[model samples]
Target: MQADAYADIPLPIDPSALAALIGGTTAGVGILDTKLRYLYVNPALERLNGIPAAEHLGRTVADVLPEIDAREDMMLAVLSDGMSREITSSGRTPAATGADRRYWHGTYHRLEVAGQVVGVAGIVLEVMASDEEQRRLDRTRHHLSLLDAANTRIGTTLDMDTTCAELVDLVVPGLADFATVEVFPPDVAPTVRPAPPGVFRMRRAALTAVPGLLERFARFGVAGDYIDHQPGSAVPRCLASNQLVVENLTDDEQLGRVAHCPERVAVYRALGMHSAVFLPVSVRSGPIGVLGLVRAGGSPPFTAEDVVVARELAARAAVDLDHARRFTHEHTIALELQRSLLSEPRPPHPHIEVATRYLPADRQVLVGGDWFDVIPLRDGRHLKAMGDVMGHGVEAAVAMSHYRSLLRLLADEDLPPHRILEQLDRMVERSGLDRAATCLLAVVDRSGGMCQVSSAGHLPPVFIEPGAAGARLGDVPAGPPLGTGFGGYRTTEVRCAPGTVLFMYTDGLVERRGEDIDVSVGRLRELTLPADGSLERLLDTVLDRFGPGAEDDIAVMTSRARPAPGGCAKDLV
Candidate 1:
């Protein structure tokens, strides 16, 4: 049978009977001409549209029910194809009924006479409750997706500014048209006490907005700028009350009050921002800052659902910010401690020129335990010591201090370099300092033209002759690292020609990942000394060649015995 075979059959009911049936039923029924102007509307439709039947005639659906999306496109499509279409639409209508917005399910079909299309007919029924439920489900799913994105996007680094930027980027053009994150300055602590009624201060950490509005919004404040909120402003109120503050800026006065400043009010008006939500970014450490969300022209005011999601996002971001805060605090203390403990070594004898350099690892790692010291001894000899404790951070740095103090005390006894290492190792073990360390000690005797060297599992020192083409590595005997409770260290003597330079450094100066230790050390041995033979210039050349790629902390020291008064030159050693 043909799809439209039933249309050829005659119906027992006539036009009057069909009109009475549609008019009497509760569902709305309407008919339109090819121009989509309504020709007939039953009493039910008049009630649904909140307009009388007489008023609806000769008017299009857009004219009578302009507030609702009645899907006129579907009617036109049905007229073109001679098929029926069912659609569900929701919007506000003039219906003074229950809710501000109403939903309806409608089916549209083409009307034909004499095998030519003349008009369209529609049946509509309200499906407000069921449609609302589906909308809620969809909104819930969208919220979950946003939260999942937050988890991956925010807190990727332990940096406060980066995290704040991530948070604002996630919500703009999705949850809001403009967003900002402001935090307390590092020197100030988050306090629960009510702020003074006159002014509230916070540093702007980040901000983001839709394309055209970002520049306009940035005129009010930029990141790292300190912003002050008025007494009754939304931000201060949100912080004081520990709750979200939603403002619909319906008038100039409302915008002024929420903006906290006249300049901001002008910007808000220019940008057409009419709605805002202020949420406190807080954790167990009281309220740290505030997050501001805004929506501009044509955007609906914030709803209760938006508040719930904004609260959750703020909570998650707060946790990450707190972690960053703590990390920053700890890092500052460690850096201070490392610097204080590693102050410039006391000036060695005027004849013995000393130059030193210390560089910490990258920001991701804390300060490490590399240290150097120059100690003046009897008989015109100066002891140059370089050592590295086995770890990074405060613990290793503190252990380095202990080892330096012990070495200085032992140096006062004027013992041989090997015996000093043996006694220092025993003292560290007995004192229960668990961290092991590698150290190289070189005692230069200018008057005798000889230097005694000892090693405790450390790299050999490099020696540069006054005019040599390349540097030579000292052949000091190796011993177990300090604090290992081993006492078999031996001392070696090397000829210290006048104007010869001795370079000592920690392992970080030459260590490279995935490369043999000998190869890494060889790269340093192949370098020529500066033509001027300046100790400072020699150290600079070494650092320039190898310092940029070092992944660990480095401490380097260079000392050269100048030509002694009335002393003749000796052969290179």
Candidate 2:
């Protein structure tokens, strides 16, 4: 039989009889003209659309039934091509009949008058399947979209709290009204033994809610708050068994069993919380945390499918957490080792007070081998040294220690700055060490009121005078970096005024990608220093302006020439 054979009746039938025949049926029948304007609708459609038949006539689907989201274009295509199409549409009813939401499976066909396509007709069947299946596929596409978005939303950073915050952000207002996450402290190692049958101490890493619920429950416990899970609570049970636990919070008796305290029970009731789910986050070693979610307001309780999706989200989060945990562990160990290797510089001489600072890259795991030292020599002279090894982490730090020790041995020989660098280069090359470094040496003669500075491919020293507009760059002869075996180094001498500040630093302080080194150097050259501030303040200003974007380690050292007492200079060194 043809799909629209019933519409081929010879003449219009009795309206009362047609209404009686289809009124009791569960299907909705409607007709429209070639322009896709509604012509007739039965009583069933009136109930389905919650609009009177008179209001539907001569109106497009976009008009009276705009909320249905029905594909009227497909129905119009059937009129022109004389083909049929079937689809399912889900939406809320019009405002007239309580505006209930529903889903309908609809079949549309061409309505023909003689041989000409005049209009289209439709038969819509309300999809009243078993309630479980209805909710499961409420819209399979919606569920899939959430899962797809989880990849980008979760695990954006290695930080533990950030990952948890991303997880809760994804589910709230879309999956539930309130979501929270609690995890063992990063210091706690994951173990196979189950938690004892009592309150387990855990850090609440993240807690969030939709605007409707945030103001009410955000005070009980917030992110970074520590709480103990009740004995045999869903969180501990879920962690122990690695299974999801779902509980209804609306039931008083059930709430008493699930909630740890009476105050919690009262809060749930006040919020109209209907249901909650606890999902365990685990890795290869064992369980580490739990993700908790609660639905309130008019939202329905979580279903079995929700459990599956929540578990998938938890699995992704657990992997990120595990990776972060391992990275943090390694970073901590390397930091401790570097600190142990690099001790503070020696005390400064009376004529020249010195200050030094070391800064590691903010975003990197390893601490690079950038170091500085102040060595007091005879005749009130101070030797200021700053250098940067080629690499990062433990090996680079160890190499830096060797370079500092070798320099101390050479300093006792009283060699000039360039001659000392020449010998150090030969020592490193003959030692067959693979690492390389850039170094700067400045010998300050306080009694003579002068400074002799040299550089081994390092940045120049900055000169700041008390009455000058800003700091000025000193002219220092550049030589090949250490370990290059380059013996060509020339020294430069500059007359220093009393109270002149000489600053030296590693390249990491100014070098950046796609920028000229001279431009970076000029920024330091134009900085104005406080006339009477402490050396600590001067160092702070320099680093604050230029240290934020450094991709490698940084070392900075400063020395100020002190005034001679009794207006008499000591015998020139």
Candidate 3:
């Protein structure tokens, strides 16, 4: 019986060595059958899984540890190839319940019995350094997403106030519990001298707060309110230093020092504010203003990462604000230049009562080249001219100046209405100027009792007679606009009764979008102007009737014929 070779044998095991190896190691060890069910789990594996060994047995990895799916395919491959492989996987897990997500570097080996693959065994070691690294990576990705959104939302228009509002919207309830943007007025001219420190002059351009705390901060300020920064306030200090000022609202002393007023401290406490940061907004020119961000309770205190994010946001907003500022500066300069060039029209002859009006288009529309002038010509005659260049903005305005000057020079030479326009057309063509304009010229002769009128593709002049029902559009032959060199202008002579009035204007006075020109001009003709009134009264009447469409610039010149000093009307027909 002793020699009968394998009567009975117990499973071989070095219990002491196995215990030492398993107890000394911190890695998790597990064995899975071909069905991917957990058959064996060491004590370390049980602890890592947050489940006891007894509970894990006979349970598939997908059933017991679903978060480890990152390595499920690798484990299957090891079973299929009967080989060993190593993988590093990361994710939330049952073992990490109530804890941060974790990463595990795992090595899987095929387990065989009797030359047939039976299962896969894996040893997993936690990689702790990746925890912080993953968090940093996540934050970086989030910041990038925010910046991308900002690109489309910010600086959508060349308007300073709108840009400020956009900046506030992007940060509210996202970067901070509440935020405010302040800036100098849009009209403030840039200067070499820095802004006075103690003056505390700033326009609250935009303000926003989280939904829960809106009412608490509403009393602080609103957009467009003029706010004064108290002396030694965080805003002015941060702007002066061109740095960020972070204040810890949780600390009483720190909050008091930064609060600058008793009211603000009370407000902060009421709102349960825990932290704040004042970031300076600066561009190439200089500091524009400051962006104030505050956080409330339940929100974590502002960290260094928050400061970095705020600084980046401020940088982007500053560039947009600077662009808007420069646009305003240029628009101002262009307006001034146009005004200077278009001073008061020279006094018309005393024989006639003349009145004129010029209205530039609204801000959204570009400034145009609309102009009107009353020139006193030789031989006691008066010249009335109204012209509009065919463009808008500074270039059109500059062209208008040139056109006005040239017309004056030609009129001073005592040329007739058509001749003056002919010379102007030649000069504009020969000068190689690319601009085109429409003009109307009228010469009122009191001694001759007739008025000569000419047009270069301009709107027809209206003649209103005393006791007439409606005004009459003059039948002057329309010619090509100036710069066309089409010198086919012909002046028309009309009866110049003492009580008659001649009204001249640009197209802007009557034109409307999606309407025919004839219809617009017809509307003006249908309005009855007061015949027995002063030139100013008649001009106002005409404007009232057709002044609705001011999208284009408008210029109106009205000249009324007056009897010369207690004499009857002269007839030279």
Candidate 4:
């Protein structure tokens, strides 16, 4: 049969073009009218919306996709600001299908045919491919690298703003060509202030002088300029009036470098940037500053990807900066107080081999008030007492100093171990330290194989006697803690044989997840110290095994019963 001749004309766009572009992957692609009607949709949209593409044509977005949160900030930004946006929506498409949670990269743009806004266009790509095994591995490695760097820098003496700026510097360049960390500082609404043209130029040198920022700035070849008011500058003065402050200033004929509302254009120009985006920066309470990124608008400025990365990084960096500043200030006070409170370690005696180790917790300047005394008594005895006063930070350390002073006074007076506890109890009650405080006091009499101990809300000392199998524990007396007004508490005498080991400590030593406090202490008594011959190594092991979380500071004292020719018998007062 002879084929009939047919004349063909090119349509504005191919009917199958979208399907061909999206392929069989079922990626959602759709077009919307000014009224948000479903103007067009591919098969993927059909699947996502849970309706046939043909059925949805010419329907309003609200009419078809009822679940969409139209008022969302990002959505509002796209509609009102004409800004492009990408959203990831997971769940079964509105079409008839089982509920399936999957991520999508939904790009929204104002559809313009001949220059006027008609409607919106959307393209949604399922996140399946991006979540592939290899990508997961790469993400894991990147996250680990970032955490490693962050961890190392966490406890350093870096200031907040400088640290944040450095962090931004680290992220930019490899990621993009421009990055900035802005601090809004408290109570100052940046949007309301008009930006001055020469403001940037005025503060450029001063800002560049900042410590960490300069080094990292060299790393990325980026620079910074601050906004400041200047005399007689000719610029469309909108920084005092406009909200959206900076735009790409690549064109020589572009508007004068100043925002009517923000007034920071000249600073942007000096900083070698054309396009800049800003986000609020905050420490714990108030807004500390603003974070921003910039690039020459003519030179491929920021993209959706850039915004995504910048926002995520900024959130974490804000926290990091806040912690750094607070930690430094708090640490300075804490360390000074801790040092002042602790007694200087005395030189070793002929019969005593004393070992003391103190390690501050990770990234914090805080040293707990865990104090141990190795006092030589009047009668050739060793009076050892380790105490933990309540909490961490400065207050606890202060209380520690007071307790040590009182104990020393009692020791100097040569009071009995029981009497010392009674006097301490009275002193604490009178000093108003009875609220939220606990202490342990144990007197070790080396000459007499016994530990005369009276405790105030403290763990009893652990005693170990040598045997064929191993060392075993002796008896102890547990009583109410100090500061609780446990009236006239008596110290009990516990026997210690030759080569017997006595260990006393505060609660910081026996803390662990899913373990009872008593059981944890008992475990320490059962386990012998490490053979490495370092008390710090032993304490570090205890700390490492327990994981992270500090209940109280640790105070540990180890001693052995003196093997004497006359006999191990002296007053442990």
Candidate 5:
């Protein structure tokens, strides 16, 4: 009477608990070993599978699953690693008498008992009401475009965490419902919730402190344990056996106690979500916390794809989360090192106020080569420069730092801006660093209201003063970017009016996939003259259209010349 590894696991939760957890009172769930043998069969699983628990006992999944043509690896994985899997058409396979077989998606969780891994627990559901017959085949046709967008989007993200979040956003909604992430330090409880506000920061803090908990969760058979904080007390569940609850709130005391329903009588009240579902967003690795997704109230139910999407997103999210934590740690060190290399802008000479913001390229360990600095010469002249190396990310960042240092040391020397570039070019080229970069440098004087600007393969600075609006400095661009072998440099003198503001940035701001420098230049002209606006606010709103965060990385530096007495000073924020 000895049943194999499939024996001895607990049965499904009682009817009361089940209704409290699942939003709708309809489905069933069960457990089976890698050999496809029934381990623990729930009453719901029996109802959906059309086989009574008494009959399914000790039977293999193949013998009982009439649907899945089981894969051997997926089977072994259940017992060996406690990995979960999905089979979407299980409900339709065994055509029930009269009712016929409705479609159901199945979600599985690897189960562990004793010190040994054993089987898999599963929940089945009818999903995707709009699906056509050719579901799997139809998705294949869109793979190329999906791959292109995925590759480009994923590649562009410099930060690992951003990349993961982007991935989840891209896949969910269409693929599943809400996606939640939880990260925690070793031996600590996860503190996070989707909220009225302030929740994002809490989630971030948990991840930063715990290094690789996210990534490790993706691999099968993570080792650890789970604790259920029940009202009566608490119970510990095996690491491999994730605890899942499905509850329809209509007749549930626990649901009432939790106040699961808020707008019980509202016309726009949520449905299908009247049923509640709770599961750990965690794996056995370290202490990544639980993720709970509550369905909309008065809704039908949580389908198989719903759970599948959550798990897959969780798998991908794990990579992102770990990377974000690690990246944060690393960025702190790099930013600290970089700050010392950059220049401190001189106080506005009673005429100018300047605000500068620098963002490192988003991906890779390589620092970006974008750099900016403001220097006040002994002659009371202001020196400003912004540059972008050919590549983005950490390596570019390191190079940018190096160039900033060299330029800082040269500022005190009696060299012209052109000569500085010539020397820096030789340094970059001969250093054999193989890194190429572009730069725009300018000099301004408060007393003279005169300006000098030079460019080396960089976006020309936008010059805006009262009345004249934005003008491009430097008639002829200086030689090739610093790292380019054959290059030239030129300078132009401009009579800048007092109260003029000069905006300089790396090419990132004006660059789009197919547009040229002229397009951005034309657009900038239109933007600057916008009847009225603060330079900072304008910069914030306009640049963001094609700038960082939602787009590519951007570096900006703005300096304005003061207004002359008796002249109408244009007040701009």
Candidate 6:
């Protein structure tokens, strides 16, 4: 039949033909009057709703399918504007043919006669199977995205607290409404014993929550505070079993049991928290801690898929926490070793005053091998030394101690500055110390009124006259660094007037990347000397000027000869 002929067939169509067409198609078809009351329902729609046609006619959608959200508002919009509308909805129906929750796509259009509003015509198709598959794919993609983000955001620093904070920050308001990370104390080994039956202790490392809940949740425990989980708590259970514990707090009793405390239960009620999950943070060693995730009002209870995502996140965070713990332990041991090796220098003779300062590099870098010492020599003279081993960490620190001990033994020989460095270089090379070192040495003879300075691939020493306004770098001869077995070192004699200050330092104080060593040294020489002639104040000013920018370990020492009483040098001790 032609399209125009089909339209001209009749003003009121045959009911049997329309029924046959609606019944033959798979889509569910229905007609609702202006009041949204069902006026007609075909066999397909009856099957979709699990109700016969007689039971659906003359009843509203809410009366027939209360569980399903038919979106009456969209149907009303179609009737008011005579416009068509489409919607995708999900809910359980009486049919129970597939998943508990089924999806459907529906299209609704206005039905009018004589250009006056009459009713709405709706056709719906069951999309449960395909929509379920699409939902699974979307969830998988979301989980993968979270894992990828964890790789870069978590463990960005080798610090325990920082790693903990990163883990919680990544999960809050995305995976959970609130999250917390708590770990066994440093002195307590995670695998040593099962959690106590009465109470379990763990230190809170990090906590984060959705806006408006952070401050309230923080009342339970802040980071660094020790929290004791009461008996039968999910955290303790998760730790002991090394598994996940999920709680759906649907009632006051369930909330009380999961909260483990009356105060927390009240907080939960106020915040409308209804679901929680506790997962063990574990590695090959054992369970190290627990990760807690919670969801509040209107948010769905934790599901199996959510548990899977949270478990993966906890596992990744566990590895990072383990690494941070190990790093912190090593850093502590190295720092102590360096400090012990760099003890205060021995006091020089009464005529000589000396001051020294040692600063390790930033926390990200391990302690380095920088050392300073002052040793008394024969004839009222003192030997001052500053040296830097060419690396960082425990091995460099050990080498530094070796150099310091060997230098003390050679100082007893009353050797000059150059001879001392030559002997040190030979001994270090023979001792199998592979790391090279730069060193500056000065022999101050107060009565002789002259100081002998030498260098072993080290920076030149700076000197300030008693009354001079500015400092000047000493023109000391340089040689190969210690451990090279080179003997080209030559001593430069600088006049040591009464109250003259001799400053010696390692390269960390004056070296900058991409800048010539000479230019860096020039910057140091241009600094005005402190007028009080106090060696302590002189070293303080130098550090205040350059210490903040140093990228390596620094060791600096200053020595000044005191003027003899009555202007008679021979009378001094």
Compare the candidates by TM-score and give the number of the best one.
6
Cα lDDT of model 6 by residue, 1-573, tens digit = 111212322322345777666767778888777888777777778788888777776678989888888888888989888789997877888887766787789999988777867788889988976677898899788878898999999999888889999999999877999999998877523244455667778888999999878888877778987777887778878888999888888788778767755568777888899999999999999988999999997778877888999999999999999988887777778888888888988667766667888876666678889999999888777888889999999999999999999999999999999999999999999999999999989887767767888999999888776677678888887899999987799999986666667788888888888889899898877655566556777778888888887899888987666555566433111
Clashing residue pairs in candidate 3 are none
- The positional error of residue 355 in candidate 6, measured at the CA in angstroms, is 4.2
How many residue pairs clash (N, CA or C atoms closer than 3 angstroms) in each of the candidate models, in the order given? 0, 0, 0, 54, 46, 0
Off by over 4 Å in 6: 1-27, 31-44, 52-121, 125-145, 187-203, 217-222, 225-235, 248-274, 295-301, 349-355, 464-469, 528-550, 559-573
lDDT of 6: 0.82
Can you give the TM-score per candidate against the true fold? 0.72, 0.70, 0.62, 0.49, 0.51, 0.74
Give the C-alpha miss distance for residue 270 in model 6, angstroms.
6.2
Q: Can you give the lDDT of residue 185 in candidate 6?
A: 78
Give the whole-model CA lDDT for all candidates, comma-separated.
0.83, 0.78, 0.79, 0.56, 0.55, 0.82
lDDT of 5 by residue, 1-573 (tens): 112343364433343564456524355565565455665555556666666666777777667765644454555655566556776563444535554445667677766656555556667665543365456446544443443455445423444446545544444333323333333432222343334432111132211101222243232112222221323210112112455444554543435432323223231122223444444434345424333444443234556655554454444444445555566556655555555555556653555577676654444544456678877666667678888776644566678877777777777784677777777787778877678888887777666756777777777777775556455443546578887767578776766665667787776677666667687656766445345636667567655665643234577877775454675444221
Off by over 4 Å in 2: 1-124, 127-139, 188-199, 220-222, 225-231, 251-272, 350-352, 430-432, 561-573
Q: Please give the distance, in angstroms, between residue 114's alpha carbon in candidate 1 and its true position after superposition.
A: 12
**Prediction 4 global C-alpha lDDT:** 0.56
Write model 3 residue lDDT over 1-573, tens digit each, in one string.
Answer: 011122232112233554566644678877677877766667787777788776666668778777765568888999888778998887766667566778788899988766877778789877764566788788788777778888999898877778988998898877888999988766644343344566566778899999988887898868987676677777778877888898887766666756656467766787788888999889977888889999988988887887888898999999998988777676666677778888878566555676888776654466688888888878778788999999888899999999999998888899889999999999999998899999999987767767899999998988776677877888888899999998888898976666676788999998889989988887666645564567777778777777766678888887665566787645221
Candidate 1 residue-wise lDDT, 1-573, digit = tens: 012122433322354766767868889888787878777777788788888776776678889878778788888899899889998877877775656777889988888877877888889988975577898898888888889999999998877888999999998877999999988877533334454557887788999999978877767778877787887888878889988889889788889878866667777787898899999999986887899999998877888888899999999999999988777677667778888999988756766677899887655567888999999989777788999999988899999999999999999999989999999999999999999999999887766767899999999998877677778889898899999997799999987777777888998888999999989888766767777767778778888888888899989988776554676543121
Model 5 TM-score?
0.51
Q: 332, model 3: CA deviation in Å? A: 1.2
**Candidate 4 residue spans exceeding 4 A from truth:** 1-299, 303-320, 359-368, 434-436, 464-474, 532-536, 546-550, 560-573
lDDT (Cα, tens digit) per residue for candidate 2, span 4-68: 22244332335567567665676788877777777668777877787887787777878986777
Cα lDDT, model 6, residue 422: 94
Q: How far is candidate 4 from the true structure (C-alpha RMSD, Å)?
A: 17.8
Q: Which digits, one per residue and each the tens of the lDDT, describe model 4 over residues 1-573? A: 111121231122445674466545566777665656566677766766667666666666556665654333454456566788987665434543445454556888766556666667777766754676566577557655654565454324445546765665455543445555444322211234455544522111112212423453453323334434343222112222222233455643342432322345554455455565554544447444455455542446665555555555556666776776566667667766787677555623455545565555544436677787777677666577777776677887788888888888888777767788778778888988743445555566555656676766667676544442333443445556667776656677777665555666667667766888878766755545566434456456656764257554555666653333565523222
